[model samples]
Each structure stands twice: as C-alpha cells, then as structure tokens.
Target: MEILGLACAAVLLFGAVLSIETRISRSDRQLARVERKLDLLLEHMGLQEHDPRLREVIELLRNGKKLYAIKRYRELTGAGLKEAKEAVERLG
Candidate 1:
C-alpha cells in the first residue's frame, strides 16, 4: 500500500511539473507575439527609429538592388519576407 501511494505521488508531481512547463511555454509564445505586434505598431507610427542596419539596405536600394535590400533587411531584422519587402518599400 505504501509503495502504491509513493508511485501515485510521483506521478502527480510529474504531471504538475509538466503542466507548469506547458503553461510557461505558452505564455512565452504569447508574450513574443505581443512584442512583435507592438514593434509593428511603433514602426507604423514612425515612433521607432530606423535600425542602423537599414542604412545598408537603403544603400542597396540606391544601387538598384531592391531584392538584395530586402534580403539584407530580413537577415538583419529576422523579419519575414513580406515584412522585409514592406520595410524596403518604405525606405523608398
């Protein structure tokens, strides 16, 4: 009977820990999404200054290499293709 109780307690503890970890992971993802949205909002409002790396992207655009500019923006900002393309377009 004691052995069975111990096994049950261990199982409960493992489950609780797993549940907590899952909640934490979900919260972290939510927080990241919120942050990304905030960043986009700030950029749209022109409240966020251009990142220094964007200067290079602008130069690429001036050189008539728009695709390279978008690629470089994505590399520098970790932005998706559409986001990077929009950012490059905004530079012009």
Candidate 2:
C-alpha cells in the first residue's frame, strides 16, 4: 500500500510537470509569432536595421578566417553552430 501511494504521487508529479511543459511550449510559440509580426511591422515602417556585427563577420570571412568568423557569428547572434555555419556560408 505504501509503495502504491508513492507510485501515485510520482504519477501526479509527472502529470504536473507535463502540464507546465505544455504551457511553456504554447507560450514560446505565441512569443515567436509575436516577434515575427513585430519584425514585419518594423520592416514595413523602414525601421528594421541589420546587425553591425555582420560586417565584422564578413571581414573575418574575407580574411579567410572562416572558423573564427563562425564562432564570432554564433557569439554575436546567439545562434547554434549549424545555423552560424550556414549563415557564414551565405555571407561568403
């Protein structure tokens, strides 16, 4: 009976965690949608600006320092390694 009680408690805790995770996932989606709309609005208003660090990345790439440029891009943009690599490739 005691073991069963502990198992039930564990199940309840798991369910609570799942519920929180679902809410967080939904919130993240909503935030992403809002950010996209804001970006579009800024673009429409001619207020969207490019990141200045992009120039530094370009310079690094031009100097044949591709690895350094990718690392710098990731740092400046908070992008993952693969995304940074792709972006650097695009710039190159």
Per-candidate TM equals: 0.51, 0.61
Specify the poorest-scoring 10-residue window by lDDT in model 1: 45-54
Q: What lDDT does model 1 reach?
A: 0.86
lDDT of 1 by residue, 7-89 (tens): 99999999999999999999967876896688789878888656776898999999999999999999998977887887788
Candidate 1: give the clashing pairs. Answer: none
Task: Give lDDT: candidate 2, residue 70.
Answer: 99
Clash totals for all candidate models: 0, 0
Q: Score each candidate by Cα lDDT.
A: 0.86, 0.85
Cα misplacement distance, residue 8 of candidate 1 (Å):
0.5
Candidate 2 lDDT tens digits, 1-92: 99999999999999999999999999967876786687678768877446787999999999999999999999998876876887788678
Instruction: Report the lDDT of model 1 for residue 39.
Output: 70
Best by TM-score: 2
